[model samples]
Target: MPWNWTQAEWPNFHYDRAPLERLEQQFLVASGEILGAVRHVSGEDRERLRIDLLSEEAMRTSAIEGEMLDRSSVQSSLRRHFGLGVDIASARPREQGIAEMMVEVYSGFAEPVTDESLCRWHGMLLSHDRGLDMIGAYRRHDEAMQIVSGRIDRQTVHFEAPPSVRVPAEMRAFIDWFNRTTPDGLSPVPALTRAALGHLWFESIHPFEDGNGRIGRALAEKSLAQNIGQPSLIALAYTIERDRRRYYDLLETHQKTLDVTPWILWFGEAVLEAQQVTLARVAFLIAKAKFYDVHRAHLNPRQAKVVERLFRAGPDGFEGGLSAENYIAITGTSRATTTRDLQDLVERGALTRTGERRHTRYRLPI
Candidate 1:
């Protein structure tokens, strides 16, 4: 059931004109100046906090119900990802077996990539305990990647995917083309549009026995990171996940024609939504920082360090239960001093303590 490359059926597409043009302006204004303050994070505790929050945000939306998580889970995943080290190449949600695979991806990276690395990355995404739809379910048999959305009348599709569905020979060639054609080696399209196109192309390829959507989105994310030379502040997929119907329809319409205007509009709108949520997150973080700015004078060095860490890895961040053991590791302070530090912060109305004994965790007071 391989794509004939000659008679593959496609989709027809259209989008409202004025609405997108106006939304595009909103998107520009929304993201404006965000990087200004963010760039101030240079080896300071603030930098540490930004890294923690950014990674936490990225991982949350990568989950099955990633768009939404209760505060506790958000904090927990933050701790898990940061503590274990989730980064660009971390265990992508599609991977399913390895313990600390996310850590591996984060710990390793440099430069934009092409070649067979995508296939390797895609494989790792489906690797141990990441627990995606199809754990390591690459195409071993001659099965085709299919679409099962309601619009298609649940039509059954059958096509041959050779080499590997995740990066079939043809699809891989296209990826190579994309990487090469990027403007002056600086990503051909804006990060936002590139992300959308990455999603569109991969879905069209229908690569992978399972986890196509998840992997495709992840690909978009990585592709975006490459475009910007850093991770983007928003989860475009989260926006798509919010209104999955239009998400599919946009794709369906575009399948018939290659005009990417509607798809670009979809991406632009998603970016704007993502910016809104990210701005809210940053505002909360800034508030937390202001609390510390006012109170930093009363805290000992260790206490200050701990507070900074807490803000950086708020509830959706990576505080690791604020256990004494971790406190000792993070600050190298004595038991009595650490206790006093934690107590001082709590007394100052900066944090709330939960759980007991070895299970204790301290977090920012909402």
Candidate 2:
């Protein structure tokens, strides 16, 4: 019963432009802080952070679509892309497909957007799902596309896309606007605002039969990268996943109104949350680096390898700390040797021991 953004007589957006100036200023300052923190890290640390953050984005974005990917496989796929050493097993085609598409999104953020480019992205995304005949093309059928919930008998339509007949024209207009008014272009609008509006517009069109959400997010990533002057390690989808209820509710509510201030406000907040989260991780990484630097000389090869793996496991370091049995399995050491190795680590103040006997766990002293 409600008119979408494309259906209004004026069909243009209205918002409090003055309030957005503050948001733009905040985003710029945060972006500089993130980039500056990145510059202070070692090149190897920076590379690892890039790979970890991009892999986290790929994994979380896929999870938002109800698809869970093995994080190691995603990391392996990215390593192969960057010519880094990959120690993991070969990834499945589906996992590789997801990772490959995300890698392309990360690496190609500076490239221009076109219908063909979007089609190719869609093709890559669905390559492992759809049949050969259905890849790399827009919807050809005239069926109504509605996002609905609840049972079939009582389904509630949250949104309905434009008819397939008008999809081409709609897509062309959207792409034209996107290319003409880029973040660095003559447009007075801030780049983050453009990213949010573009995301809403793309979702309303729903040009493809699948993967529209992923593509829209990819477009947002490109927009932010363009605005900030480099590809970012902060993953917006991570924050979206954390605030998914609000994310969905805002989109559902705002899509029906020409004034989309609420959605834009939520998007700005989401961007801030993502950067704040990344900033915390950046601090954790710096601490971890200092931790290693302090203990690097005291560690033997086995202890170093185990410490590195645990650190890479994340800030918590191995869910419950690495068990001695698990350590032996990983280090291929005998029980006696593993016991002495762990005790030596504890004695050297590199690790703290918890529990006793078989339940014993060793974690970083910090």
Top of the candidates by TM-score = 2
97-185: candidate 1 lDDT, tens digit per residue: 11223333333322344544545555654454444454444454444444543556665433333345345565655566557534356
lDDT for model 1, please: 0.56
lDDT of residue 102 for candidate 2: 76
- Residue-by-residue lDDT tens digits, candidate 2, 252-287: 887788788878888987888888888877777888
Q: Assess candidate 2 and give its lDDT.
A: 0.81
Question: What ranges in model 2 sit over 4 Å off?
Answer: 9-11, 131-133, 300-302, 316-347, 352-366
TM-score of each: 0.58, 0.88
Clashes of each: 30, 0
lDDT at position 61, candidate 1? 42
